[model samples]
Target chain A: MITAMSDASAPPVPGFVESTFSPLVHAAVHRCLGVAPPGDGARTAIVLASTVGDATTLDTGSRSLVAGQAHQPLLFMQSTANAILGRLAVDLAVTGPLLSLSTAVPDDVAGELLTTGALLLETGEADRVVLVGVELAAGDRAAAAHRALGTVPPAEDLAVALLLDRDDPVPHLPELPAHPPPAAPPDGYGTLRGLVALAARNQGTPP
Target chain B: MRREVLLTGYGVRTAFGTGAEALRDGVFDGRPAFAPVTRFDTGPYRTDAAATHGPAVPLREVLAETAAAAVRMAGLPAGARADVLVGTAGDFTALTRFWRTRGRDADAGGAAGSDGAGGAGVVETVPAWQAAALADALGVRGTRLAFTSACVASAMAVVHGCLLISSGRADTVLCAGAYLVEEENLAKFGSGFALSRDGAVRPFCADRSGLLLGDGAAAVVLESADGARRRGARPLAALTGWGVAGDAHHVARPHPEGAGLAAAAGRALRGAGLPRVGYVNAHGTATRHNDPAETRGLRAVFGPYADSVPVSSTKSTTGHLLEAAGVVELVITLLALRDGVLPPTAGFTEPDPLCDLDFVPNRPHKADLRAAMTVNAAFGGVNTALVLERT
Candidate 1:
């Protein structure tokens, strides 16, 4: 069984969120596994999942620069939902296939994240794989409500990263619910919120 | 673990006429279908030549006409249900126009009553929604996907269709690509100096400066070999292999060294299980940058055989169809493989010394082609290659 979850946000320590989140999440997961963080050169795999990949930074930059130019908004390149994977790869120093997927459907997104994370561990693509789901809030009220309800959010920014391993302690929840998990949080805040919930759940002894 | 997927049927709409007969006649008789721009006012743009239609036809109508024709040719049941995959650069040219007009109206302080009813009013009018329209028209109840990968959209649609069949997700898939001329896109290309000046397209020619824009739709019915056999369907050609690669180098220009193009070609060849190829239907946009880059990439991959393999650019006749170019050229490639005839690269006169290859020029050539490859390189450094084998 694969088990690990953590959250990171952009509000506090925006610059170091990605770099710090991986090691922090790694430490939390290692604590649960009763192992130390692997040193450099140790084989580890990472699969980044995000709806607002590199496109976020590109969008911010484009919005900043569009005021001066009379050209088409380079919005096309600014919205790829895969930049987070590249950041995670750099942070974790992972040398493995980085798969990025975007699903508008919430339930499907959660299942896909778990399934992909499981595959990476099973296939030996990575010894310990990290699955990250990141999204930016759309500044819409309906989106925020959806994020809070674990359903399709109207639009919110959140990021949640989960570490999955083959030899990890399984969570002792009431039951593995048959119903699908709600869509992952929006890009920024939702990600951090979900990660917090994951970290809290993994804080105590493994059952 | 790739499975064999076949192109059991195809449909096409072009300026020459609709259906396979018209396309075949246009290809064989050396007919050019380019005419004055009718879809929009060309005064703001400098170009005079385009594959214009008599009147602006709704995309739904255009898709239905060609799709039904292809279904009839395939002899599938009228009520047949299959997966639907649509490829296009722009989903709704008319919708975009509508939005632009709405914007103008809002700016002029027109009453908001023209916005129509309900919050879902304008949202339902998007071109992306047309995929569902086509799916509904074909009575396809299985998976439906819309791909918009610039010029490589339709080719990717074909690739995805094959994947769907091989993965057993669907027994039959309708892979279609469409593009109707939009003023903004045309003006953008014209400003970029990519549009041809002579009101004609001349690919791989020494004097070739750029490409001429055209609008049309092409679709293919893909099915698993076992499924086709079970249905007693005769396949026109087999979709042997396909490869998609991103340049990650530039947004508009291809990799200066043709790295991504070569990689995509290698992947397609590997997928097809063929080390050498018989013919190549090149992207050959006729632009100074595209032609030479493609020629160099071909040489890098095919080596000595590159000089001998009869390569042609159908864009010379059809003009650059943007997203629809891949499917249109693909249909032509399938026709070539089936008929054992290599279509000519229409506009070649004096060959460029840099592009040293045997580009079957002026007229079609008869040959015993076992396999043919089609290449498409998009503006965003997205490159795709497809291999088709004679059935």
Candidate 2:
């Protein structure tokens, strides 16, 4: 298993402006793809799981349209959650089956991502799969709504990407531990915080 | 015999109205559903025409209603163990409305410093999460997944759902694709020249321009053959094979040679152990590039038989459903197989030499269809093909 986490403030992909979500996805996907063994791109699949999705782009695009601003095609391009998935496939040349998914409940998002990766490999659809969980921290208005509703709002933006394949031996990371008290309520949305916690536990000094 | 994937139930919520009957009647009526866009302002775009479900309906409500309709059609128990997958291209009009409202408040300095909290509407806007909402709404107890692969989302979902059943991971799945006509969507596609120039969707016609957006949702209940048999469920059709491929050539345009699309069609046929395709549901979006490239793909896969096979694009009548096109076209193909009536491409006129297929133009054609194929392509250069056979 290979795992990577990008901080909430990862820089945008070079040359593409107005896309915060794609950069995070790009970073995570790059890291995970780097770890994948050399093989046929046709046998590799990707499943992206997110809660908040590309809300940053959508919110920005909607605001522009409402403000009567000029049409920004790049913004519209990134507004769809699958934009980054397509970019990843094009960039890496991996093209078996691609899926971009979101789960409403944050807690269940991580498990869903993991199970989907395993299912894809088990069904013999692909020899390898890239599983990415991403969530952009809510914007000010939405965050305020959560706080006003007494919800524990996301603390920071974050993304986690994992490379999983069938029967590939590696230093196995234990199942995620019980939730640690989040420092500052964590950041981003969905399973980012949980994924961050898992990455941290896996990277700490060996027991 | 190898275990087959069975489609036992289908439900549709489209501009023609709900259920399979509406879809059949609407297509055979030989009229395009494109009308003036009602859900949103098309701004300065050349065309403001789209196929819509009258007023805006919440995505969740449409999903629930269609899920119920599919369940009823399949005769599943009140609480069937089934997964649910939802394929959507982008946020619904309500989501954009939520953001637009928030932007207004921010501009007005009403809640700029309110610590980023949002209203109830924000809850539904979360990506991927809507699958869970749909699963809850339908009371399904199996896995819930969401997909957004542009035009190929729902078709990809159906392909994966069948794999899940074939692998014995799940017995049944509710695969649905949905889209809503929104102003943001219209402006983007219109600016990109994806919408028809004169508000007419004339696929494969000499004067073809582009596609018109459509709002709709469709769902099919898929189960393994054994599970259906044990439950005494009759198979409406068998989902025999599927092919999914990425163009990796362009962001919004298909490969000039239709390489990826041809590969997908070939893979589907090979997987199904078929020599020739009897009918093809073309992803004929009426755009200049799509029609010719799709024609090339059909020719590549069917070869000389391409001249004999009946090929038509129902988008001519229903308009383009974007992400929902995959599953919607699949359901339409299944209906064609069941009724032995090939749906027509409603707006065809003088044929383009580049597109030489025998498009069942302007009227339905009756034929003895043994197997059928439906193909769809997306903005990201993803192409998918699903092959189904009569039960």
DockQ scores of the candidates: 0.08, 0.44
- Across B345-376, the per-residue lDDT of candidate 2 in tens digits comes to 88789999999999999999998999999998
Q: Which stretches of candidate 1 lie over 4 Å from their true place?
A: A1-207, B78-81, B90-92, B107-110, B113-128
Q: Against the hidden reference, what TM-scores do the models get?
A: 0.72, 0.92
Tens-place lDDT digits, model 2, residues A46-156: 788776567667767677777777657777666665567667777888667777776554355567777777777876667887877776666754453333323333555
Q: What is the C-alpha lDDT of each candidate?
A: 0.61, 0.76
Q: Model 1 interface RMSD, in angstroms?
A: 8.3
Candidate 1, lDDT over the whole model: 0.61
Q: Candidate 1 on A30-137: residue-level lDDT in tens?
A: 333334455321245444433222323332323232222222333322222222323333344443434444332233434445654554455343466655554444
TM-score of chain B of 1: 0.93
TM-score of chain B for predicted candidate 2: 0.96
